[model samples]
Target chain A: MKDNNRLLSRMFKYKECYLLVAPFYIIFSIFVIAPIAIAIFFGFTDFNMLEPPEFIGLSNYLTLFFEDDVFLVAVRNTLIFAVITGPVSYFSCLLFAWLINELPRGLRSVMTFVFYAPSMSGMLYVIWAYIFSGDMYGLLNQILMSFGFVKDPVQWLTNTETMLGCIIIVQIWMSLGTSFLAFIAGLQNVDRSLYEAGAVDGIRNRIQELVYITLPSMGPQLLFSAVMQISAAFSVSSVCMTLAGFPSTDNAALTVATHAYDFGMIRFEMGYACAVTTVLFIAMMAVNKWIQKIISKYADV
Target chain B: MKFKRSKTGPARSTAGDTAVFMILIIVGLFMLLPFVYAIIQSLKPTEEIFAYPPKFFVRNPTFDNYKTLSQLVDSLWIPFGRYFINSAVVTVVGTGANLLFSSMAAFAFAKYNFPGNKWMFSLVVAALLFSGTVTALPQYIIMSGLGLINTLYSLIIPAAATPLGLFLMKNFMVQIPDTVIEAATIDGAGILKIYYRVCMPLVKPAALTLVIFSFQGLWNSTGGSYIYEEAWKLLPTVLNDVASAGIARVGSASAASVLMMLPPCALFIFTQSRIVETMAFSGIKG
Candidate 1:
């Protein structure tokens, strides 16, 4: 009888744990789940917030893909950004993480801050805004002129050709801290014996060791970085907005998110915006899956 | 014959390696060059500021920018001291709540074996897929409906339950042994008690990491539309005003940027190594 009571009580206790964590599920379901559903469903319809939902089928997607020049531009800009910043940001963080990893713990952490500070450092957008201002007083222009590198102020943020690259560079600096930290975590977790084994195998230097061991051990993190960079490039907004004002300096700096803002928020083309987002979402899913497949293939190799 | 002729046991890094290293070093320096330049420029006195060729290092520096910073701000909006306090209140309370709630949820996921647990955990992980980046529009609309636009709570409430935090805490907590939970249960403890007293202490490292990230996220938020809809009084959102004002308080914008960034910088510096190795869990597995 006593044993049965203890078993029953233990079962009740487990239920209590479930109850404790239920709040997260409740809030997450309401806030996150419902909106995503709304977005997905509304993508297939012609419903703005002000109007009742009207089924438009895939017209929104069709228009975004076929007609919207800005959507295509966002797609191109996003891809270009992902491709350019991907390897550069990844390797930079790796280098920083590796550098800090070799040092004493106290000093190592200090250096982490120096590099990571920019990640969350306030008003980076504001400062960059000043630096990239269209006017002559902009820092980049002022400096270039003072150095005789240029005779006049360049519209760095305004120019379509250079605007995207400028934004990517700023982003790489402003937001890479987290990825860098992840690399450090991975680096620390690397088993010491692997290096010792390589040394015994007569591995000549750091480069060989890095390629043969470090790269392979860090495959998961590399995958993580790839995922993050792709998503980040996809969600590009603030850096562009700050560098150029809203409407994004002739709409050249527009990404899918910016396009959504223009449509859903600014123009109130909520249904059309949802359709655009759906396209972007499908594209990202395909890309993510494709990357995963490639990784698997390479693993086999 | 030279000893070098004896063996080819392992390939040495060639000139390519040295070249790559130099290139990487240059890249790292370039990465840092702007901030260094900003520091140098921030230090220059007003008289020397417009020198024909800008000085890479200031000759005679002053605290002029920092002083002018206060007077330069529109107190009705940002209200200098209030921005710091507002940022602090939001970040602290928000981060604290995230750490506590996330860890508790992570504990249940890791230790318990209830029905639907797997599905629930997967649901939680999917939350990571939808981020602040994409959810801002819906979130803004919700915040406005709730009448929480310009308050410090604007930053805290919506952000308090981040999916990444739950994921991070769970991943870390999984590494924790099951025996600890078993032992706690044997001691006649309640689930909340175990979560609060036992699991909380064990997950301190992960909690620290969560603290670092949440603080960064909340502090980094600029001009939540809902907030600007009502009143404009936060460090980050205030930057929008400072930027739009043109030449009047251009110096103040720079100063505000510097001031706004200082805490995160300090936090980054203070938790530098830890931020990477443990707390940030930036997932360096790559």
Candidate 2:
């Protein structure tokens, strides 16, 4: 009887502890988990919300694999985009963070504002759309023309090649602040004593110190942000749609998410869209898992 | 190695200072050029807005565009001022809800002894991968059933339960010392009082960080028609329309774009000092 009571009391304590964090789980399961499952199911069958789902299994996958041109286009486009922006964005953010950190205390915050202003504005698309407009009047074209580069004006967004470049450029601009701030935070956490130790051990300079120590120390945050960039690069849209125009002049700027939206909402090909979205989902998750494993080895956060 | 080790240094900053100065100048010019272009466009006459070799500087600046936009106050369903107020109300109320509820939930997870907490918190953290788009279709249906489809609650409610904010707060709260809570308990404080009087102050810096990110997200976001309006209007959506048909709508589009971007830019300037301080507090400082 005494043993039973002790076990019951310990159980009660753990239960109380569990109760503390219950709200997050309960809400997450309903909104996040349930919907994603529904999206998966929606992909496997013909369920258009208004209509009953008629189970159609592998057909969606088959068609997506072989027949659909846009699916392939989107996949190709998204991978190319991730390849283009991921490393460049990562380095720039770290560089910006390093610069911001070295600034005197009072001015650092204000300077970061200028760096992050485009992102904080929420109207990045608004400003950039005008600058990259196809007309000769566009700021960039005006610059090119004044420099005697083009006779009339080079179309920036309407073309096949440049539209993707345009989207990537704008994305890089908006992305720097969050990752940069996080990098700065991570750098601050590294003990200055370590640097002193390195110096005493005859480390030559800041460059060597940063490469051997600061970079390794900043690894966890860097990994998280890098992995996040991969996923974000895959899921990119809205700006492409708004800035470059959906069904872009040459279908050049069709990203994975835009394709999903186009097929899912605009075309109402629910099952097919789901299959495509599932591919994106799987690809993202695969990278996420790989990166998570990598981060697991390093990240304390 | 090159410079002899002097015990008393002559402020070895000048060399580093030059490098820092050059970096700042390059980055500064890169960021400033686009904004300066926007300002120039906003100030110029309509015809010149499309003139070849776009004007880097406005010859005759005018508020005529701003005046006209301000007067579009009577445009049928909503006006410029009304839209601005609506946006502010939703953003402020939504941010408040996020700060309160997420902090409460975070505190509970951080400090309290509760059952199923570990698996539950893990579940919450993992849910970060699901983007807003994936949740949209069903959430709309849920809101429809709740009779919130046309109300600001659609915007406010969903915006309040941000996974990112909750995650950020929880991460920060984990750093809060357990000793403070133990002292509070010794004082015979109730859970609610302990939370309000003790833990909340400790969490303020993190809370403030979330506030900036949350406002940035909520304000800058171009919410779909399903949330913001029965018609679903936000400045970005309006700007999208203007850009698509920009050949004829250049004046309105340019003015509208300027207005849309200016508030957040100004607000960013205002909170910039706070961002630095928050960075320092969160140990993201220099």
Per-residue lDDT for B198-233 in model 2, tens only?
A: 777655545665777777777755666465462445
Candidate 1, superposed: residue stretches over 4 Å from native: A1-20, A129-153, A190-224, A245-251, A292-301, B1-28, B44-60, B72-83, B107-134, B144-151, B171-206, B228-232, B238-246, B273-286
The CA lDDT at A219 in model 2 is: 55
User: Cα lDDT for residue B18, model 1?
Assistant: 52
Cα lDDT tens digits, model 1, A1-301, are: 9998876777575787678677666666656666676677877888667878799898888888789888887877777776777667767787777755544456456566556656656455555765776676577887888889988788888887778878887887865665676666555545455665787888776667777776666554555455565566566776777776678766778877778877877787788887777777667666666775665554311
Instruction: List runs of model 2 lying over 4 Å from the truth.
Output: A1-27, A185-204, A208-220, A296-299, B1-13, B74-81, B106-126, B131-134, B173-206, B221-223, B227-249, B275-286
Model 2 CAPRI rating:
acceptable
Each model's lDDT comes to 0.66, 0.67
Which 10 successive residues of model 2 chain A have the least lDDT summed?
A16-25
Top of the candidates by DockQ: 2
lDDT of 2 at B177: 61
- Listed for every candidate in order, the interface RMSD values in angstroms are 6.5, 5.0
Best lDDT among the predictions, by candidate number: 2
lDDT tens string, model 2, A56-154? 988888988899887888889999987778778878888887766666665666667667766666655557887787786687887877888987777
